[model samples]
Target: MRKFIAKTVEEMPPSGIRKFFDIASEMKDIISLSVGEPDFVTPWNVREAAIASIERGYTHYTSNHGNPALRRLIARYLRERYGTSYDWKTQTIVTVGASEALDLAFRAVIEPGDEVLVPAPSYVSYMPGVAFAGGVAVPIETKECDGFTVTAQALEAAVTPKTKAIILPYPNNPTGAVMTKEQLAAIVPVIEGSDLFVISDEIYSELTYGGRHCSIASFAEMYPRTVVINGFSKAFAMTGFRLGYAAGSEEMIAAMVKIHQYFMLCAPTASQHAGEEALRHELDTDFAQVNKMVSDYNRRRTFVYNAFKKMGLSCFEPRGAFYVFPNISGMGMTSEEFCHKLIHEKHVACVPGTAFGAAGEGFMRCSYASSMDNLKEALKRIAEFVDECRK
Candidate 1:
């Protein structure tokens, strides 16, 4: 059996985040703050559009790059919101979700022995995806003092002859860190002369609690070199639709679409219709509903932030994303140890920081994606568990 498996596939580590989520699932009484997804249902209008498409006998494969209408909508949305523009026909490719876009982006550009610089405490998928594409993932640590953002100096230091690309995941998962315009601008000059490409995962772009989400691709120098990955999962609560898209320079998008053609054929036809609707004013209506969701998330964000502060745990104030990563080192326990003891003793489930990367070992990621009541209860249980550990 071992001999039959591909060496790379077999050597890959199982997802660290899912291990604790599986444990929590089997427990009798558990409050799960472990999953990184929206608790909100897909907006009624978006869902209805999909159903209507199917009912209208429109259930067929779209173009490999996805429906032209949806792609145009995606392109326009990015331009109007972030000031970045990509040609809908040649520079955008709809994907099965940002997951597939990320995978395709890696496969399209990475060559054997190439090194992709990934900032630490990132989404768990980036490293494995790079490895599967025969590229090495070089981790650049982002410090808490720097809001977990990789500085230009650090990025320059990580560059080597083998360095081929960089993975910039903002409103970052696990850490909830966001890179400001100035911070992103600082790195532009650093990589200006280098031949490195960038894969910017801005899936949580719409969930930022800050003024506005800025894309590294918005910079004139970075635009040509960056591939932007975004989707409807976080903002529109459309995860089940399994729809996302990638925007890059025309050449980069064409390469990714070639891979997408052979593997995925096309994204779900009905879902593409829904995606177009998601971008239209009809769905969000001045974004009042989306704003409401953000407001609620902000409330829960404050709850978790204050709860950790009250518990005397050290945590960085996250300006984006729904997660709060708190350093639990003072409890004298490894991240895994603290999480395991917490779930068993308090029946409150949160992911260990180590789940994100080795640098996350002294912390834990608690998502506020759960309901307000659930978040409050989970916080209470965590407080009690910390107190008991202290005693």
Candidate 2:
């Protein structure tokens, strides 16, 4: 019997989210706030565009870089939303969600054993994807004290002789903490003189509240070294469509597209068209619906924060995204233990913060992406559990 496995494949552990989701599946009567997707459907115009594209028999693959129209639309979308310009022909590459874009970016740039910096409590893919591409994942802890902003000092401390790139996961996952322009500028000087690339995962770029989202790519000097990874999943509730795009300098975009060409060929043709339509027509029209969701989430955020405060479990007030990463060290339990017990005993399903990284310990990520009704039920269960634990 052959038991051959690559060292990289063997070293990789299963995702923490999948582990908890799997455990929750066997538990009965659970109210889960562990999901990471938006609760809204893809808006009407976007759906129509996809269907219309299909009806017109645009079923085949377009090109290695995806449909030209979508690329240009993405350029316009980025420009209008973040005030960044990406030349459609030379700088944009559509991908199979942001997932493939991440893979391709790593493949394009990472050399074997090259050091890649990743902040704690970030999206799960950065580490494994970098490792699979033969890059070392250097996990840096970004504490809640600084609103999860990666400071220039912290970044400078993490960089080494072998460091090749840094993953900036903002409007960050499982934290909902956003970086302000001032905070973003705080790290600019660190990379200004370096040869390292910045792989900014702006997946939740549009979900921001309070201030407009800023792109690291907006800085002209850093522009050449920045690769912007964003998608339709979080912003427009188009997860199933699986369309995302990356924009960067010509050399880097072309390098990424080379891997994308041999690997994915093209993103789903229909979905790409729908996404183009999403950028062109539905964004402004759907802002009301999008804002409604944001407003609802803000209300839910206040409720959860207040409830937790009464229970003596204060968490950061999330500014963007739909997650609340609460430090539950006061609960006197490991995050996994707390989450598992909550699922089985209290009938509530929330993810252990350690699912994001070691620095994520002593906390739990409760997402408000699910319905408010579910949130209410989960909070009641949580209160009951808190009372029982206290006793």
TM-score of each: 0.98, 0.96
Per-residue lDDT tens digits for candidate 1, residues 1-391, read: 7999999999988988899899999998899999888999998888899999999999888889899888888888898889998899999999999999999999999999999999998899999999999999999988888899989989999999999999999989989899999999999887876778999999999888968999999999899999999998888888899999999999999999999999899999999999888898533476776788899999999889999999998899988988999989899899999999999999998998988889898999999998988988889889999999999
Stretches off by above 4 angstroms in model 2 are 283-286
Poorest 10 consecutive residues by lDDT, candidate 1:
281-290
Which residue pairs show collisions in model 1? none
Error of 1 at 264 (Å): 0.5
Which sections of candidate 1 miss by over 4 Å?
A: 282-284
The digit string of per-residue lDDT tens for model 2 on 262-283 reads 8779899999988988787645
lDDT of each: 0.91, 0.86
For each candidate, how many residue pairs have backbone atoms clashing (under 3 Å)? 0, 0
Specify the highest-TM-score model's number: 1
361 in model 2: Cα distance from truth in Å?
0.4
Worst 10 residues of 2 by lDDT: 281-290
